[model samples]
Target: MNAIEVNVKNGYKVIVDNGIFDKIPEYALTLADYTTVTIVSDSNVAPLYIERLKKGFLRANKRVLTYVIEAGEQSKNLSNYAAILSFLANNDFKRKDLLVALGGGVVGDLTGFVASTYHRGVDFIQVPTTLLAGIDSSVGGKTAVDIKEGKNLVGAFYQPKGVFFDIETLNTLPEKEMINGFGELVKYGILMGGTLWKNLLSDNLSLENCIADSIRYKAEIVEKDEFDNGVRALLNLGHTLAHSVENLSGYTVPHGLAVGYGIRRIAKACKNNGLLQNSEYEQIINVLDKFSLTYIAPFSDNALIRASVKDKKAFADSINIIVINAIGNCSIQKFKLDKLGEFFND
Candidate 1:
């Protein structure tokens, strides 16, 4: 069992272990013994994990309920957010009760937002199923839904009381789902300088260590800048391009794949500006290619450029993007929004 403790507003423990799903009820007791649990899941995951989770809570004699939503990026919007809020309201969930986010990133974010807002705040736990969620979104307090304008436009930095990572579920994951987490996982390698980058290049990097390194990097960032007023932005290394590609593709593409393509684009920009060396840039591409993450956007160069302007990171004059200064370290560069055109298909 690998357990990481995060120090935030509502500090939480992220437990990563094999077959932790069966232990959900066991951990819930450690959070709050006598609270109601509303497990928020999506269509894709509900059929797989819901009954097991429900049974876990029931065994502990805790009153349990579930709220299911369609599984997709589109589902993380105002309509579903409102629906979840209504579910809790109608059920009379108190602030002392618990909201268990029981799926991947989308489910976690939407449920966390609902927990944060409903009754001014309620206790919530994260049980992220996807590799993407397990490595990134599940540990962080960040939660939000997308709008027509952009991704994560409406959300909050609301911490969960606990996060449980059930690695056994990964055995059931589709190939694309594995790539989704790998997309975000690569960012940690870029942000910190050390053996992490070197280890990532080798064929022997275990799945558990990959997730752990990513969480450790993210946990430290969130601790210092929980509100995202500073260093936390470093975590968004390839995200600016990520949002644009997803927007241009109409979100038909998976976020992890889009992030891979976005990271490719950002690497090009870094190489052009001399921030990254020729060999280092090629090595980054090699790693991505090895992971089967080489993707090209179907959108035109101009279209991608235009889509980037709508990102939340874009200010009236500039947008914040992470540039690779070396293999293991990345730095945020604020460039004129119009100059974002520099990153288009090259």
Candidate 2:
């Protein structure tokens, strides 16, 4: 059990590990005093490992409940959030109970939102089944659902009790999904630099191993800044355009894919702004290309620029962008949202 303890602002430790699910009973034993646990997942993931997690919790003598919703970004809405809360209410879940988010980013986001609002707040654990969840969503306490207006419009910064990453689960992930997740891993490298980028460039590394390291990197950041008021925003390296793409695509594009596209565009934008050198930008593009990501946006330049203006990061008239200063460092830049038009022009 390789455990990394993430000390969030509240002084609670979030433990992350590979193959932690097999030791679920032991993990649950550590939190046995909680009144009840509601394990929330999506349709796609439930069929894969829900039973094993349930059995593990049962073995630890924890009373467990399960809620399974449809998979995909479309399901992340007010209705699903309400449904999960209603389930918690019907199940007599208390403030002291636990909510286990046991799937990908969608499940984690929805469950975390439900946990944050249910009885004002409750302890929740993240059992991220997808590569994206393990590397990004699960570690941060950012819980949200999409509204008619935009992605993550209705959300809260609620940290999890812990995040458990089971690498074995990746064996079942589709190749496309793995590629999507790899895009996020690459984002971390682009934003933070360090061993992550090096490992991604290394031919010997496997997706599963890279994911564990990405999660570790995210955990380290969240431990230092839980609220995303400062360094945490660095994690949004490609998210500004990514969210815009998601909103424009009506969510047909997966979050990771949209992020992959956003990263490419951002690299271009950075080069245009003279923040990133041409060679560096090309290297970033090359890595994204290796993953088979569609580095180009599907929409027209004007449409993409318009969608970006609606991003929540837009303050007043300028958009806050987390741009890469180099391979390992990032900085936040505020640009007139309209100024992004140049990047789209041929």
CA lDDT of every candidate: 0.84, 0.79
TM-score of each: 0.94, 0.91
Candidate 2 per-residue lDDT, tens place, 224-304, comes to 788777778778888877888877887778777888988888888778878889988888888888777765667876777
Query: Model 1 off-target regions past 4 Å?
Result: 338-346
Whole-model lDDT, candidate 1? 0.84
lDDT score for candidate 2 against the true structure: 0.79
Which TM-score value belongs to model 2?
0.91
Q: Supply the TM-score for candidate 1.
A: 0.94
- Clash number for model 2? 1
Tell me how many clashing residue pairs each candidate has: 1, 1
